[model samples]
Target chain A: MRAAGKRFAGGRSHGDSRVDQFIEQIITGLSIGSILLLVAMGLSIIYGSMGIINLAHGEFVMLGAYTAWLLQSHFGLGLLASLVPIFIVVAAVGWIIERYVLSLLNNRPLDTILATWGVGIMLQQSVRLMVGSELRYVQMPPSLSDSTDVLGFSVSSYRVFLFFVAIALFAVTWLLMNRTTVGMKLRAIMQDRSVAASFGINAKRVYALTFAYGAGLAGLAGALVSPLKSVSPDMGTGYVVDAFMVVVLGGVQSLAGTVASAFFLGELSGAIAFLQNDTVAKAIVLLAIVVLIRFRPEGLFATRVRT
Target chain B: MSISRRTLMRNAAALGAFAGTGFPHIWIKNADLARAAAGEIKVGVLFSLTGTTAIIEESLNKATILAIEEINAAGGIKGSKIVPIVEDPASDPATFSEKARKLVVGDKCVSVFGSYTSASRKAVLPVFERQNNLYWYPTLYEGRECSKNVVYTGAVPNQQQDEFVPWLIKKFGKKFYLIGSNYIYPKEENNYCKKLLAKYGGEVVAEEYVPLGHSEFSSVINKIRSTQPNVIFSTVVGDSVVALHRQYRAAGLDPEKMPMASLTTSENEVAAMGGEAAAGHFTSAPYFQVHKSPENEKFVAAYRKRWGADKVTHFVSEACYFQTYLFKQAVEKLAASDITPPNIRDAVKGQETVAPQGRVRIEPENLHTWLWPKIAQAKSNGQFEILVEAKEWLKPLPYAAYPGQVCTEKGLVEKS
Candidate 1:
């Protein structure tokens, strides 16, 4: 009995070692997943309230990156200081897009998707023309650039900061959606736009604010990602595709579903990356989603609410 | 708005005649009249204007345009102004093939140039063969593919691998980690390198392949740190190269302890990676920033003047710019009465040009060029400081140097 106990203890140590390794992988996955969530949350909010896909949604992120780059290059503002004005400027741009362009496409889902796709192309090409289709440099501040030791694992400080930021944003977004009157109006409109209009809700104003809110989130995601990745005109396309997949996988109308899907997809992608090539990993994830759709028909956590 | 086909053909023929006489005024007038001409000298430029490969294509477009401008300035070929029609292709092979057909059949272009990816090139090969048009592919590709209708103006495996591998082995004593972007170019190149390294008694510590355009490299970088290789043989292309370099720096990996040698990364890539990101890296290519010849100096000066001083990098765009001049030299050598597609192809095959690198002679057998290789170190300012030149031009042995093909007569078989 003592011998068996000793063997079990040895096995437990080995299993504990593996658990430690898995924790590191999860951290990495969460870091990446958080970025996806920031981008997709904006996508979800716009689609949920306004009933538009906003294909150019990725461009908001691109613009934020460019804005950060321009600030650093021209004004010599450090990374942290640059983010301050970038948030406001990007948010303002988002508000303007909501007011002028997306507002007009309200109630026309197909037209909104096509129009936004066109706008995305135009925005991408305009950046291409201005900056010449090359990757721009976004220097990380020295303090955030280095890695920190976390229980014998080296984790990037920037990644940890990004996680905290995403969590804070998620909380604030939740409060805005659930606690505030505007939040109540948004939920009402998302539930039934015609019915909400009948109840004296200003659908137009709600849409504009919802769109702006989504765009602002995208802008924040872009700014956060700039230090981590190269800033290019076409950088947003890849992220946007992944974001769309996350949105669809999570049940587009459910914020909680979107968050769940982001972490699920992120961890799935990362774990597969460890086991196989990234392209193969992505293909497998996409295939898994396809198989899930065959069984579920309405995503993993989709609600049966009609728009 | 619809015009008759017969009228269009007649107007086209008249314009061709006017263009043939070297009368620009009459040709322009006739060109206006034959606005929908079917037999016009249609040339296709297939490039990636979007996606990951856009950086290389942007410069290639500029170089191609410069070449077209020079050709038209010199009264064009056989007095018929060369008309270049462009298509994006969007970095997709299916799109490349579709666009190739549109250029060959719909536009009736005799020849086309552009295609950075081997997949895109392979995609358009059947189209070119079916339509019997010429394709001048202008990027370094895996050797083994030899087509009758294709002219590969870029470096082959022997021109890049034979010189680069041996030099690296001699200099760094051959403990290599073969890291590359998971694609045909890197896979084939690494396969060839592994065999060559075996011949030299060198060890490849690890061989890793990452997906194209993957932004994160902490895991791969960690793997590299653990391996402790003498030198890293990298074939990572596009934006991923930047990510890898950034991770390497963040991990505090010493460049001297584990130097990197790359095949695809160049000055253009360095610029994208930024000076700090690319500092202390080494790459092997036929061209560098410090090519110090009178002709090269002139070329560099002219390039800097045209495109800003900050933008001139060792991009395929630079090669494409010179390729235009090379094409013109060949065209002038032919000086045929009717400078048609077949005539231009023959001219290009029959001639040689003194390029910025060295005297590049186009082999009639494979339609690839014989050129020199130069090793360069990435400076802090995103430019390559040319370290050593092979001096003499290395003969392009596309199939002969391939490991599997070395013993086969089929590999040595050349086109008649």
Candidate 2:
């Protein structure tokens, strides 16, 4: 293991005050976990509730990122201000894909994967052709641009905001899925689509809304992430893989599971990366997840409800 | 809007050279090559126009085309207009090989200029070597090979690091934190850097590599935070460059006291990260658009006039522009029929050009060029401020780190 905490008088830190690198690693892991939660929340929702392996979920993220870039560049809209509109715009695209494409191949989960993957490629190319492949940047809100001091170590306030936002989004999503009427209908459909349809529920409408919501969440993730990462067509591909891993390890249909798994993966990756290099940390994380999945097939927080 | 205006202007410029299938334009590059098949000399232009590498390679394509157009306008090489048969390899090595075959065997092109990554170069090397054709690679890369069929116009390891290490050590303190993307290129670069540090009596505080496309830098930043290295030698590339810079800034780490000296960060990356995030970092490169010279000014003006004012000319594009001239200078001696790979190769030895970077010439000893290496600091306007430029051209030593290993007119050999 790397040495724990050697004090160095550099950048904000100086003189006698010392912060444990171990504590800083925990914060780093939490930051990483929050990022994972931010990106994978949408994937968790769509895949968990709908049983749709949304390969185009990432494209939706890309689309939102492009939307964010366009808004900022064209209209001088800040990222925070543009979030709702970005969500709406990406949600509409998601609605169209579900209504026109996914609705047709409803019961066939495998074909949805192929079709969504194709859709993702189409979206990426469409953006590339229209926008051109130059790197576009998004500016962060002025307030969160500075770092916040936590236990003598500096953490980006934007990242701290992201952690809160992830929890907030998770809370909102969980409440929406449990306490609301839309949530009731969605759960009814998830339990038995035919029975839900037979009863007074508009199964088609609910599915479309759920998909749109999922896509919007992805859009929000992308919009938030745009400032940190360069906005390009292929940017979402990286997040999509990690999002998939989070969703799978979280137990596909469970929101709580998604949150838990995102945290688990993020902390694991962050702590290991601090000790070892990032590459080995990645391999180790993947290996750990594989072993976890092999033993606990239902994953971390699988819903126990049979019906 | 700035986007539409630039797009409209670029669309008009793209009108002549290559036809594109509508937006996210997968270019049908060979359509117009047939028009010049009769009078113009055929030269293949292989660059990835779409996919991940397109962000950089697209400029290279434009540079090559601009040079070709300039040559034709300036009465061409021996009055024979050069026509480029452009092909998009889509940033895949296998596709690069396939395109190379089609360009050399199918189109009967005299030469091809292409590739940014080493893998793509390696892929296309066999096709060029087997067919006895020439390939001009313009990207600075990890140098270990000496292909007789390829002419490297970019800086090798020594040309980039030899001056960079000592200058950084003298200016910034010597406790260096070596970080890069997990790849052979960064590893090779760090090896050379370590060698230089050892010679300079510098201390290495830490070494690390993150995966490509990685955007998280908090853990890495935490390490940098506590370790308090005097300098951060970074080769973390692609999307990671943007994240690392922004996060470093966000983490309140000042680049002034502990600056990031990079081989990977460039004008393109600065654009991606935005000037505020990128400013104060240093990059060791052979060329920067901010470099003042008559040749560079003219070149930039022409490039902007053709492409768009919004577009920035970078080191690779500069090399691409001059390497085309280097090709023209070599091919001027040959009769149109005498334009085989071997004859052109022999003629290209020591061919000189006053590039945007500075005076550059192909080394007769090796197929690589002698470059004027410079270190530049990123300013707040998405541009570089050229700081320290070499007094003279640094000879490209492909195997400078490995001492005895050298490339000559024949091939790679050990001289110790």
Instruction: Give me the candidate number with maximum DockQ.
Output: 2
* Local distance difference test, candidate 2: 0.87
Candidate 2 chain A weakest lDDT stretch, 10 residues? A1-10
List, residue by residue over B20-109, the lDDT tens digit for candidate 1.
Answer: 675222211132323224324557788888766786786777667767776777787556566888888878887788888777666666
Q: Which stretches in model 2 have alpha-carbon errors above 4 Å?
A: A1-19, A304-307, B1-37
True contacts kept of 1: 0.34
Q: What TM-score number comes out for model 1?
A: 0.84
Clashing pairs in 2: A48-A253, A128-B24, A129-B23, A129-B24
Interface RMSD of 2: 9.8
Q: Give the runs in model 1 whose Cα sits over 4 Å from its true position.
A: A1-21, A192-200, A292-307, B1-44, B50-52, B68-95, B98-111, B130-132, B169-175, B225-228, B400-416
Alpha-carbon lDDT, every model: 0.74, 0.87
Candidate 2 C-alpha error for residue A277, in Å: 0.8
Q: Write the per-residue lDDT of candidate 2 for residues B1-416, one digit (tens) a residue.
A: 01244654665577534534424323334543442345678899999999888888999999999999999999987778898889999988988998898888777788899998887899999999999999999999988888888999998999999999999999998899999999888988899899999999898999999998788888888788767888999988777899899989988889999999999788888988999998999999999998999999999999999999888998899999999999999988877667778888999998898898888999987899999999999998999998999999998888888988878777888886
Worst 10 residues of 2 chain B by lDDT: B19-28
